[model samples]
Target chain A: MNESERREAMRRGPLHGPDLTLNMRSDPRFLTGARGLIASVAEKIGLSSTSCAQVALAIDEALCNVIRHGYKKRSDAPIWVMVWVLADEGVGAGLRIVIEDEAEQVDPSKIRGRDLADVRPGGLGVHIIREVMDVAEYEMRSPVGMRLTLVKYDRPSPGVEPAAVGA
Target chain B: MADQPGLNVRMEQVGQAVVVTPEGEIAYTEATQFRQWMRKAHDASPERIVVDLTGIEYMNTPGVATLVEALQSAKKNKYRLVLAGMNTNVRSVFEVARLNTVFEIVQTREDALA
Candidate 1:
């Protein structure tokens, strides 16, 4: 899909489940609650336990970036989160989490994970988000701020044996 | 140190080492509290420090960053810092960052003490 088409798909989301929306303050205290909600929603949408945890972690990292870099630790700043359960044809089932913040915007193309060779703190958030989510996209919002959309499709491992029927 | 709502930290001295165990989530919300416990444990001036992560099932980049800071401090001060009892979820973050090779990690706290 082209850039505009992908953006439109993201905007429309999937029609499987009701979208969960949260407009929260940019405070660290809110992260735990948000993580719990995302994990629960991901699980309800048929994501595996591991995928649920990974999706939650990705959302947590995205919010942390908004609070730390975008808002510069300003607790009162506004941050919005929207979660959707995707069931696109051929793509199977998945979860999408979009985080928006009303803070200074930066070039999404320049938001690359730092080199891990240096072994430092503070720069691993982006890497974690990208690694956990199948699709990690960053874009500048109108007026001001940034938006990060992360999607993870449910792909069950074939190596694991299926649960015994009734036993 | 006292425990927060979502995170709790306990520290004890064992032989020549200080073991710090943190329970609950250690993401951005609790990283500062977890770091304070690490600081307190380091302040005791033990020959080694081992962080026992058995009770923690979820940890984010901030949590990993806090441990990294502790590791760097241990290196600068000529002391040993080890991590133990990381669940698969927590360990994956380390593996993704390729920090499994940088820090000393053990399967159990007893192994860390050893």
Candidate 2:
């Protein structure tokens, strides 16, 4: 999908309260706008600026990873992001974002952090995804595609825990 | 082989503070320009330095290292470095680096000045 088509796809998705789903056609602009929209939703739902920022950043990195490595240019790849508020006693209640991409399987074994001494710039996407969120999980779906889920602790204020009920 | 777009930096002064805004991706290919902007901001010796990042579209580790080094240089010079206007997409790069804590982040350039 192209930029306008991606935006239209997001618009076409179901919009029930507390959950938002966006679909983008593997476009470069998705990173920029997708991240922004997610943050806005989190903020509107009372996620602190920090937590909202965290989830947005992590998701952006995930999308960037998909574009940079997941598919050949102009392929029929599609990216999906599903987000909802999850209250976890472990994470102090935060936004849970699930990012899915319909691209070739990425060998998780090939994912590695760059050496601090080696000092390069472009290899940090996966590292950032793993570091920026409370929990990062990956799994391979049958037939195709990879799913990445990230959680952010969206506490309204510092040191205060909100009530969380399981989804 | 080097036909990629160049990273761009724009600046504005907030009282004694000078805010440097970088747009587009700041990767290995563009770290030099980022560093140059940071250096220029440092040499200006403003009472405070803030990087307005709402316009920054993407950054990577090498790009991040450049910011860390900038913060260190600012500290050595006894100037407080702050980051403001972080867009969610760009902020993700910092969070992955666990760098959100290392830098003083504010919501707006006005906040940084205040």
Candidate 3:
């Protein structure tokens, strides 16, 4: 694929394997349900329990970011989450979680956690997602909103340490 | 949305410190209420605030952020905030986020009281 073609494909988000799609209201009440759903999907894909927990936490943070920042804590907004398993060229297998929201688009360059040295509340969600997932990308959806894709390969990527406790 | 049953926080005073024991998952839904409770405890001017996290099974970034805010409040109020009895899973979040070194984490409520 050429550069422009590859960019277009990337903008389409990850389209590999069958996926479980969940349409969630922007309410925080659905967080538990989202976690349960993600956990079940992760287990079905043969992820380790620890890995499942990690993925669940990452998805939870992402959803929270959607509600808190994207929707500005508006519970009536709509959010869609899609999950699937995929195999990379040299990374073996992994799980992909795509979250789409119709809220205002966030600048790609501004999606990051604040300095950890500050030691204060807030701004850790993005950091957690980046640290836990092997591949995380954000794309501006057509017309409006944003799409966040998070992929966690079965094995730890080079130079990236697994964030699991006792690792 | 309606209030979620995922997290329930109970506040009580143990000697000079106020102990807040949060039971169940501390996800996004519960972070707000949890932070309110922590703020209330901090505002009471207790010598210390002990957060007993023994009953927590799951916690995410928002939950951790609540604790971070509470710790900051404690510092501003000149009171100590001690977190105790974090299960491996919950404690792992702090460790992974590198916040474990920034907070006063003890093995148990007794250790926190000490």
Candidate 4:
């Protein structure tokens, strides 16, 4: 295939993300805006500012991973991000989010958040997810994809045992 | 753009005021640094406090909570707290969390000058 022809074919592959979810875009600038959306939903669900912030950071990291590592530098690739505020229909009653991305399978065993001792810029995404959300699950989807579930409870973290509780 | 750390909350106590600046992302990982700075600033017993967020990059959930907690503590200690220099992202966070009504946000460091 010629260069132009290959480019057109890639464009035709998959450009549209799941319309069912909230505003999910590939633009990094819009990430701040997405976090804003999460914070709004979190407030309605009675999330503290800290919890809401964690949720924002967690979602930001997750989406970034999908866009960068998941999409493999493909501009036209699609990533699925869904938000379920006050959703209780799942196996357990709580706010849940299922983020599906069209990328290579992510091995849960190999995933580890950033370590506090290390001051690296990257590698902190997954760690933020695990620390912020009540629970985080990473696994492969049935048909052909990777799925990540993030859950949050309304209860305040009393005497919150903060991780890496030092500068 | 540079993926800078969300905040770099540095504190300096003036004669009767304190100034804080946050620089990087404030997710769960960086909340403790923020907490320490806040704890230290509160210990100074400033008559007025100004938090300058001009250089701040991004702030996650824990950061937001720390700010709220800081604001409340300032109020409790009879310190007039002024938060200024919010970028679009920071402003969006306050607006989303509905803290715009709870804190005093200004346009510049000059506005927060004691």
* Most accurate candidate by DockQ: 1
lDDT at position B32, candidate 2 = 71
Give the per-residue lDDT of model 2 (tens digit) for A1-167.
46556333333323454387898877764556787898887787677776776666667667767775777644357888888765444435566677788778866666666753443345666677666665576777557988776666653322223453332
lDDT of 2 by residue, B1-114 (tens): 122364678877878898898877775456677888888898898989999877776665557878888888877888999998877756766665666877899998778888
Question: Could you tell me the interface RMSD of model 3?
Answer: 0.9
TM-score of the second chain for every model = 0.97, 0.88, 0.94, 0.88
**Interface DockQ of candidate 3:** 0.80
Number of clashing residue pairs, candidate 1: 0
Between candidates 1 and 4, the one scoring higher on TM-score is 1
Clashes of each: 0, 1, 0, 15
Point out the higher-scoring one by TM-score: 3 or 4.
Answer: 3
**Which numbered prediction scores highest in TM-score against the true structure?**
1
Which segments of candidate 3 are over 4 A away from where they belong? A1-17, A88-93, A158-167, B1-4
The residue-level lDDT of candidate 3 at B65 comes to 88
Give the per-residue Cα lDDT of candidate 2 at A58.
69
Residue B74 lDDT in model 4?
Answer: 77
lDDT of each: 0.85, 0.70, 0.82, 0.66
Chain A only: list TM-scores of all candidates: 0.82, 0.73, 0.82, 0.70
Question: Who wins the lDDT comparison?
Answer: 1
Can you give the lDDT of residue A63 in candidate 1?
Answer: 88
lDDT of 4: 0.66
